[model samples]
Structure formats: C-alpha cells, structure tokens
Target: MSDQKASTRRIVVGVDGSGPSKAALQWAARQAELAGGVVEAVTAWEYPSFYGWGPAGFDFGDNAGAVLTQAIDEALGPDRRGEVRQVVVCGNPAAALLDASRGAELLVVGSRGHGGFTEALLGSVVQHVVQHAECPVVVIRGPAEATRG
Candidate 1:
C-alpha cells in the first residue's frame, strides 16, 4: 500500500541484549511512535570458535537466531515487538548495522554493548557505526547506576 509506505519512517536499531541496548530499543520505539516509523532491530553474531579445538560442529546459525530473538523479545516486550522488524546476521556488529541502515531515516544504538571494559563510555561497535553509517545516529545511554562513594 503506497499510503502505508509513505507514512512509515524507517528506523534501524542495534540490540545486543545489554542494558544500554534495551534503553536504545525503548528510545527507538518511542521515536518510531512519534514519527510513525517502523523500527528494524538488528543483532549480529559470528560463528563460535575455540582456539584449542579444531571443530565442534556446533549449530551457530540457530544459536545466533535465538540470541537475536531473545534480545528483541527482552528489549521490545510484547506490546512494542509488533512495531519492530527483527534481523539476525552473521557478521561484525558495525557492518551489520551499516547494512541494515541503508535508506533508513534514523539509526539508533546503545552507547556501549557487551564489551569487556565496564568503564567504557562507548563501545567500539557503536563508535564505528556512528562514524560510518549514512543516516543520523542516536546513541542511547543507560541510566547511571549508583556508584559506591
């Protein structure tokens, strides 16, 4: 339907099952509601490999899909999930997000994801996407946790 297509603004968001990612998803959903846009929630995963072992014959594709689904379910919840389109791809987070963001009006992502450094303000993936993505990027920062004085 041309009417439906015309009314829908396309928003792409990255989700990695992290707290900030959840916040990003919520923000993206709210933005979509205000703009009458549809959100594309993307999660990127790579094949699991062990250095010591040669091959485990693990089903990484299924696992990747499941992880992406879980992230979407957890982030969007039931009420907002219908407004989002979920995508799981096997690649780097930045590349996947960049690919998904083509022709999108906006791109949203968490400031930090499942990175090792807890003190990091920005994850490498987020930084890469911000620099490379064609669309405008919105980085969602999670609420500050209470710090021990």
Candidate 2:
C-alpha cells in the first residue's frame, strides 16, 4: 500500500496559450518526468455576461480547450505529448489553478500571463496563486534558455 501511494504523484500546471504559460507547462512536464508524476495541464475560460439584449450580444464561440491543446502540443511537440493530460474549465485562471491544486503535489504557473502588464514583475493570477494555493507552487519565468532548464 505504501509503495502504491508513493508511485502515484500528481502535478497541476496552468496554461493560457501564452509563451510563459507554454514554458511553464514544459517546466512542469520536465519536473514531473524527473519525479515520476503525472501532469495536469489546465486552462480556464469565462464568457462575458452581456446584460440585456437577450444574451445575443455575448459570444460563446471561443473554444478554450482548443487553445489549451494547441499550447500543449506546441510546447511538448509531437513526441511525448501524451505525458500530460489537458483540462479546460470556465472561471478565473487563478481560481481554476488553485482548485486543481487540491490533492496535487505541486501547482505550476507562469510568472506572467497574456494580459499581464509588461512592467509588472508578476501577473495578478500568479500573485493570487502564490498567496492562496493549497499545495506548493512553482512560478516559471525568464527566457526560453532558462525556462527549458
């Protein structure tokens, strides 16, 4: 029983179709491989609520799952892509990642995301996760040279 428990390890990573997020996923995958853990690559999406107009103004046409999948594919490449499991949800990115972190050995996210300000050191989502994640969190940052390591 102890051996079985030890063999089962999970790592949660957030993806947003950004360069940093892709790097984060790569980093998490590398870490998972080293630690013998499974990687849960998650991406969150939320439709804008258009008050009045009978909801016709709002567009739910965007497919968040496809974006996330493309990010994963681009990061991992054709080979070894199956090592990571893709997950898509509807909510705030930080909250989604935090929720997924439950029962996970680690939670990984990019230092900054797509909508983050260039001058900012850390994005709001990263800041939120760092403050509130239930498990240990890893923030992936820097250039490709540094991130790939």
Candidate 3:
C-alpha cells in the first residue's frame, strides 16, 4: 500500500513549445526520475478569440497535441521520453496547468517573456501559476545548463 501510494505521486509540468518550457520539462523529468514519481507534461491551447478573423479550417487541438509531443521528444529524448505522460487542454495556459496540477507533488513551468517588453523577468503564464498553483511550483528561467547535476 505504501509503495502504491508512493508511485502515485505525480510531477506536473507545463510545456508551451518554448525554449524555456523545454527546459522546464527536462528539469521536471529529471526530478521525477530522481524521486521515483511520474511526470505529467501538459500543454494548453485556446480557441481563436477574434470574432471573424479565425482561420478557415485549422484544428487548434491537433496543433497543440503535435506541439506537446514534439516538446516531450525534444526535452526528454528517446531514451526517457516514454516515461512521461502527456496531456493537452483547450483553454488558457495558466488555468489549464493549475487544474492539471491538482494533487500533484510538484508543478513545473518556464519563465521567459515570450513577447512584449524584453526586460520582463517572467512570462504571464509563469507568473500566474507561481502565484496561484495549488502545489509547489518550479519555474525554469533562461536556457537549461548542459545536463544539470
């Protein structure tokens, strides 16, 4: 029973197809491997908010799924990729990560300004999750060092 309970621990990670997000995923995967827990890689996409400017026939869900898969593959590589679980949500990134991280042992995310002011420290999603996540959150900033020890 204790063993079952231990393995049930999940480390949730938010991936946004960004370099910082990939670093977050890598860090989360290493942490999960070290702690004997599972890694849940999550990504979110929102429907086009423009009233009539949406694309003709593009499926955002599919695109999101592809992005998540690619991120996992690139971050974890082939040897460790199969160990992490993947999830895609259709909504705001911050809300989706928070919802998915419920009951998780840890929530990991990235912090790099995707756009806007270049001097900003944290991205909007990372800032929101850091403030509001139910679990302890780890924010990866800048590029991950070469194989962190």
**What would the TM-score be for candidate 1 when compared with the true structure?**
0.78
Model 1, residue 102: C-alpha shift (Å) = 1.0
* Residue 6 alpha-carbon offset, candidate 2, angstroms: 11
Model 2, residue 99: displacement in angstroms?
0.5
In candidate 2, which residue ranges exceed 4 Å CA deviation? Answer: 1-7, 51-62, 113-120, 142-149
lDDT of 2 by residue, 1-149 (tens): 24532456878899988778888899999899988888889999876574364455443325788888898888889887336877888888888988888878999998643332553557899999999998899988846443332
Q: Candidates sorted by lDDT, descending order? A: 3, 2, 1
Model 3: per-residue Cα lDDT over 1-149, one tens digit each:
24543458889999878787899998998898888788889999987768367777878899999999998888888888336888899999999999988888999998765444553667688889999998899988745442222
Residue 4 in model 2: lDDT: 35
Displacement of the residue 127 alpha carbon in candidate 2, Å? 0.3
Order of candidate numbers by TM-score, starting with the best = 3, 1, 2
Q: Which residue window of length 10 is worst by lDDT in model 1?
A: 140-149
Candidate 3 accuracy as lDDT: 0.82
List clashing residue pairs in candidate 3. none
